[model samples]
Target: MTTMTTRTVEYPADGLTMVGHLAIPAGVGRRPAVLLGPEGPGLNDVQRRRADALAELGYVALAFDINGGRWFSDPEEMMAYIMPLLDDTERMRGIGYAALDVLRAEPRTDPDRIAAIGYGTGGAIALELGRDGVDLRAIGTINAVTTGRPGEAANIRCPVWAGVGSEDPIMPPAQREAFAAEMQAAGVDWRLVVYGGAEHAFHHPNVDHAVRPGVSHHPLHAERAWRDVVGLLAECLPVTE
Candidate 1:
């Protein structure tokens, strides 16, 4: 196995000091890169580990932050910060772009060939960036397929793949239809995967504690989701040696 390097990245966003985790693939020169986002709480070790895993696949990955360095173990605390940001498209774009800049600035990243991915609130932020007209190679989200403002989704120039658990009440059938409609109306190349028998945030392995109803970890589906996202990246943003 090839070795990879990891480091801490601190920056400012949302009037707070943000800490991001960065992973660079070994012996790289202008490799495709990805900007990863976290769930509502904030960036955590899980995201950091995901970034490292992506690096192992020969891509630079930066797990960006939301809400500075704080991870809200309390649902109310998370909602207090995330709920308002959801209503502000530009704020989300600003947050997403900050990490994009960091990723692009990396020496090993190919700026023209990049992707954005996130989970939960992080996924929403990635979608917001696409709506804001960023030229990303691809966009992938797990349980974050929130529809953008009508007509704004046309700005998304890359293929988008979204996955959600079939039983995810937070993003139930109605919401899925709405998201598909938004993508259809915009003429985007989009795909959605509904994992059967899974619940919300199924991609998160450590979400064993059901802080909120209808959210739990599905180990089998989580593995499948990872393979699906990796396939998406391979198809949309193929990195060369």
Candidate 2:
């Protein structure tokens, strides 16, 4: 079984007390660390499971909360709570940096081998961190809507992998194409994977209530996306055997 720990940490941007679930492999000595950012507000069991899975892969993973200890079953309510926070890019960067600090401070975590993975709004934050030159080894995103500000891609120094569903209305084909163009123009080592027949929030298995006509989860695509994420991380930030 993987060793796991939970703690509450204060988000510096809003001074909100947020819960963090940390999982680490047993008998570890400075293992690679990953900051797993949640989809909305704070983390839930799904995010914890992702961290646990990372631990099983021999990496120390921490899923930090952007929202306090609250979650919403209603999609509108969740969007209302999360959307206002996204307007403040500086605050988002602070949250990401604070989470990175928490992960680096862990005994079993290797600060130098750190990377980040985010979902939905969190994915934008992950990209923001990379754009701000956070010195990460790699960054990965799942169904990110925001392609970021102008000239932002040029600032990213690490390898980035972004996965999106072709059917995702939130991130349409034009947006993905533009994002790809920006990454290519910036000369950043980036890869974009458009999964066919998948939609937004595809990795979120519990998000059935928010299923729109063009937005819902597919188990097969989600599995493939998860595997691809793991493979990308392994390639960029492999754990020391």
Candidate 3:
């Protein structure tokens, strides 16, 4: 295993002080980096571990936060906060950009060779960054099948790969179709993977808090989705040893 370094980073975004986790691989020179986004509930050990795993794979990884440093355990509270932000495209873009800037500022990150992979709300932000015309190597989202403003997807400069649960009510087939249509209309390279027998946020493990209906974890699909994202990164942003 590669020796990895980890730390907490704070930055301003969306009128809140966002606290994020940063992980760097052991190597000396700059390396390809990844911007990781967590689920709507907020950043936790799950995402931090993911950053470490990415670092172990030879990439500088930043697990950015969404709700500042607060992690909402109540489903109602999580929705109350996220619903409004979801409607505000600029706000979402700002959050994503702020995290991206922090990641790029890291001495170990190769600014030109970075990718964004987010789950749920974080996934939406990644798409927003792509829509905002950021030059990303690849975009990967889990359970975030969101569409941007009219004609905005044309700004995406890299391949996009999204994974969603087949039974997810929040991102039903229609929403997925619409997202795909938007990507197609913009002529962007994109693909969607539907994990059968899974529910919303299936990539996430069962939490200690109360979750809304239609959300459950499937260990098998979660691992499969992880592999898919890793493959996407390998294809678009290879990490050299």
Q: In order, how many clashes per candidate? A: 0, 1, 0
- Candidate 1: residue pairs that collide: none
For model 3, the local distance difference test gives 0.94
lDDT of 3 by residue, 185-234 (tens): 99999999999988898888874225677888899999999999999999
TM value for model 2: 0.92
Q: How well is each residue in 1-241 modelled by candidate 2, as lDDT tens digits?
A: 5455544454544577767888877764789989999987468899988998998888889888888667766667887988887777888888888888888888988888988999987788898998888889899999984666788778898998999999888789998988888888888999899999788887888555344556677899899999989998889999787
Q: Rank the candidates by lDDT, best first.
A: 3, 1, 2
**TM-score leaderboard ranking:** 3, 1, 2
lDDT of each: 0.91, 0.83, 0.94
As for candidate 2, its clashing pairs are 41-67
Which candidate ranks first by lDDT, i.e. highest?
Answer: 3
TM per candidate: 0.97, 0.92, 0.97
Candidate 1: tens digits of C-alpha lDDT, residues 54-103: 99899999999998899899988888989999888888988998889889
